[model samples]
Target: MDFNGKCFWITGAASGMGKSLSLLLASFNTQLILSDRDVKGLSQVADKAIALGARVLTLPLDMSDSGSIRKAVSGVLTNVKRIDGLYQFAGISQRSLIIDTPLENDRKIMEVNFFGVIELAKALLPHMIDQGGGQMAVTSSLVGKFGFPYRSAYSASKHALHGYFESLRTENSLNNIRVSILIPGRIQTNISLFALDKDGKEHGKMDPGQANGITAEKAARQILKGLRKEKKEIHVGGKELLMLYIRRFFPALFYYISSRIKPV
Candidate 1:
């Protein structure tokens, strides 16, 4: 419960759930290293956190670029001696049907949502192991559990996180590194608005489901509590999360309903 002096590094901290979590932790006397490609937005979040009493550092990161990830990791190590946790909240969404999407779009989605995620975790693994132990949590979507319309590539990328991080967790049973995969239904973020289209342009529309979801702050509170308990998979959201159970327990009914839901 008391997080005073603990250090947490979060990506995609410029907006949405990452920014919400950053601000929430600020009141706990925690040290935060926030990263995002939006340098201006990251600065604004950092400034706000400073106002809230957290020791904060801002790093510019581009999830689609390996060089940017490396530079940011180096910066964190240079300034912060320890990371109690590394929360990977950076990802991109897709809004085109598989038939309309190009192969290039799939690659682009993987590069950011999958490669960028594992690269950061791989880079920090040694340090975390050497320092005794640390926790790693990655933000995943509800589609990560099963297929959904207009999210072919996006779902694949999130699905990949489950395989990679689950293996990482089992492999590090002795190393003491804990990995938590966050499966969120919807959290009122701009993910849908910024989703990539078939031609790689932003969809630029607010999804009705996204607009009706819980606030990022509420999602963050659930996440923080789950991470504190070191839960293996933290599910966040409202009744929308029932999909996970339906997919697991009532596969036939799930298919029937999922096929009828309109993708906004």
Candidate 2:
């Protein structure tokens, strides 16, 4: 897609890969509508993008609330003319034994990671279809491709996104709407620290593995390249891409190895 002069709406734009993606798009002279629950951080992103010569709009959004997403998208369309792409990146992760995980925590994770994506897509898809063409990129994870211990809720939510978006892509292909799912392994981000525990509260600590992973900026660049080519799916970070293929081809062996590995 020609990003120049196009407008992209991105959720979770306050920080991490979302922020990096926004910055990368700004470099391409794309207009951006950035949203996050953190109004202060959203403003900072908009300010930086604006200074870099990109037309930026910031909205404080609560992804878990479908109503908020509808209102925000309505407000954006009420002002900005059109959105060329929709990047669904707002999500929450969790690290806890499923048996010990609270039902509320599981609901929260699904709310932000799965339901939020669905609601936003439902709200914005009409605009894209009406315009004749558009792209929808979602940030799933390696966990989305395969299940993992201590991440049951996160895995389920992302997996749901994969299934739903794939169907959506097929259904909308005739309408010129494209969908891209991002499977990212550990990328140096605070996802682990912010991941929820059984009580649905932030874990408040970083996972060493993720801390040593690839930079968010690098991941963003790779993701955009894949999106520009309209790839069905793109995997970022290290050997996780290969692992995903292995799992698809050698499920028994992959499952055995995955079961033995521990994430810190």
Candidate 2 local lDDT, 1-264, one digit each (tens): 889999999998998999989988997788899999989988998998888889888888998987788889888989887889999788889989988898888999999999888988988888889889799999899989888989999999999998999999999999999899998998988788889987778899888878888999999999989989989998899865778878989898898899798854
The clash tally of candidate 2 reads 0
Cα lDDT of model 1 by residue, 34-73, tens digit: 9988899999999999999999999999999999999999
The parts of candidate 1 lying over 4 Å away from their true place are none
Clashing pairs for predicted structure model 1, backbone only: none
Runs in model 2 lying further than 4 Å from the true structure? none
Say which candidate scores most in lDDT.
1
